[model samples]
Target: MIEVEGVKIDTRHWIGGERVASTRSFPDISPIDERHLGDLDAAGAAEVDQAVTAARAAFPAWAALGPTGRGAILRRVADGIDERREDLARVETRDNGSLLRSHRRGVMPRVAMNFRFFADYAEKLAHPGMEVRGHRERITYDPAGVTAIITPWNAPLMLATWRIGPALAAGNTVVLKPPEWAPLTASLLADIAHEAGLPAGVLNVVQGTGAEAGAPLTRHPGINRLSFTGSVPTAGVIAAAAAPNVVPLSFELGGKSPLLIFADADLDLAVDLAVEQFDNAGQVCLGAFRLLVQEPIAEEFTARVVERARALVQGDPRDERTDVSALISRPHFERVRGFVDRALADGARALLGGGPNTSLNGLYYSPTILADARPGSEILTEEVFGPVLTVQTFADEDEGVRMANETRFGLAATLVTGSAEKAERVSEKLSAGTVWVNCFFVRDLGAPFGGNGKSGIGREGGTYSFDFYCDVKNTVFSPAGWRES
Candidate 1:
């Protein structure tokens, strides 16, 4: 609640075992109202160096806690997140225009699992022994050094935990750069982490803009690994930043995710899935925004989806009955609207509600359905992160898969098929990090979530999550070394 210049910036910086601040700052605006959220001090180069230095310094002591002890702390944090689930959801809703009910019902459960699943697997994460045929040495996994975790604002706390929980559990110290828009949830987690008994510098939270805080954190020589969750373009910057050090980066980037619907698919079930794609107004990087249906069912499915869209009620996220809320800000709303306008210009007809809801001062964009969007139109190809959806028909299964992979992104994909063989076939051809057959957005913390190709590098969630957040060192031992011991 640290508001400056009529803007509320959560200036709470967790560094060197304490929460403090930096001397320099910048303005933060709430997207919901274009109101000044606050002025935030950009963590300067020196602060970045100090934070990374602190992580470097803390790594030895923190990692020395060993697997079991580290797991205990993460597990405790998971329990704490559960205990404060309601508060976290409310804060997240306020900070980023997320649906409170979705956060509580859909997200918190995953957050809890993300912590515990990784914690449970922490001890087992360390390598056993691996040998290559004709090789004289045994290889073991070891933590490289301090990690930088840069996350987007869409699902701030959840994404942050997805990185931090595993990084700490795997015996790596962290420098977490949460999106400036939603720093409060990270701050809250920091407090809970300290109470959960994690060491001071083992988990550090730095609040600042991407250029000021994020770039420096990624480029810092002290950082050995980087895990980022954001857009592809932004992730490109991170990749470039990490390049100088040849630092390994795990990116959970953009998605123009396609939902392939077979003609035989259930129309009722398909419409239900359509709303999930527009979840949180479709701000999700993994949002299933592209709905690619087979030709036979396209017209009916499109109409039914449009009907469902019209039925949606946009209002305050806190309202239990509201099905859709506003986009994150006016800019986002404008961007979404712009995409819709372009679609219509390209001959796509709006079969459902399209445009801003003037009735609501909040960043409300009505759920829109564009029928017959040109194959390469911006709405069809680009990630229109709003309540807008594009419905395109493919003649057959192969064509559906082709249309689905038309974008530069391959983040997440969903396929609905009655035949298991069809799903299996489609799953193989689908180029995404996560493929939910007959489903979408069902997450198990132990399962890996990420994308392929330009969608961004690496994966998140599960035991392997720590791998991206951590650089692995090979500890090779020969018979001679064993003899020496």
Candidate 2:
């Protein structure tokens, strides 16, 4: 057991409702200061097969419990999460270098909300019923057995439960493979669910790298459905692995999402949202790291945004005053810095931070802004996935919309405009899965959420979530005594 912020956590693979003994382990390093937290027990192919076998054996009984029965247990899991919210939040912050306050106030609560909201929705789910030409049709959703959920590291627990909640609610057994970088909270959650009386093997967590554990899980023939949120390249590999079994796959991949500021927009709100790109040190998959502004207000808006970006505090993530913290690791920090270095070398001007934070130490890249970035520059088009912002100006509404829709990624976008008409008009043209108007990161649990093209393959939220986690079956019958042909 390893203790983080007074919370004792088990860092091991949770399979078959118990912590499995490890043949090998990987070091868990804290991004906060590069300290060794613990050694996480790694699960190889054998352990993954054990998990799948367990899940398959338990699937029938778990699914026998209808949505109402499943929901009752899920609510208890939510209660357990609420009870340990602070402990989970503190461990997540220590593991991932995200803001402690944000984790406490927002992320951890959302984790609990993910379970509770999906539980309520599953209990109240209504399938379509219709009658035509004296024939009645009843549509039913049956749980897809043995779902494999692979989540990213940025927002570990919240994203994991975002998929896990619906899968479990729909009465499907799950084998979750969390990113190796931040895998501790998942172990904590497995304990919470077990303590809440979740059936054995109903929810299993296999902890290891993609190659060792995740690859096996994806390829396991028992997985009826697979949901993954990560890089597009990695998604491709998972797709190929799951192809032989013909598994149903859902992906929420990378994003170079745009934040478009129209001329009629509120400058202060736009500026604030622009600086929000630095949130989580820009590790967020949906962050609008690319800033496109209308030429009329680009100068004023850019100035205000740069001033605000400069004022952003960069320090220990545990500090309440700190706004930005370290990147996930030294390699990620170097990758982010490399993007800025190349952009500057290619003549993109740095309006604010240009490189690592010299004042502070350990993987802290200053919140960077590179203005006058060439249209097709790598910095302008690619995902930095760090606290680096690239600025570009558009002449008019047509150009603004065109620029915003230029990226291959359609994960999300933010549009700041005062006029509802323009908000309606411009949002329609942007090719993103979700669009925010006059705000950023405002989410509704019921909304259909996913991306188009390379960003992702399918949506997951509310009924959309159930749609992925369950299979639909249509039952048609002749009305009254009508005879079938």
lDDT of 1 by residue, 8-50 (tens): 3346688877877788877666555566766655676777887
Please provide the root mean square deviation of candidate 1 (C-alpha atoms, Å).
2.8
Which pairs clash inside model 2?
A: none
- Model 2 ranges off by over 4 Å: 480-485
User: Which one wins on lDDT?
Assistant: 2
List model 2 lDDT by residue over 53-113, tens digit each: 8898889999999988889999999999999998998999999999999999999999999
lDDT of 1 at 316: 79
Predicted structure with the largest TM-score when compared to the true one: 2
**How well does each candidate superpose onto the true structure, as a TM-score?**
0.93, 0.98
Q: Give per-model CA RMSD.
A: 2.8, 1.7
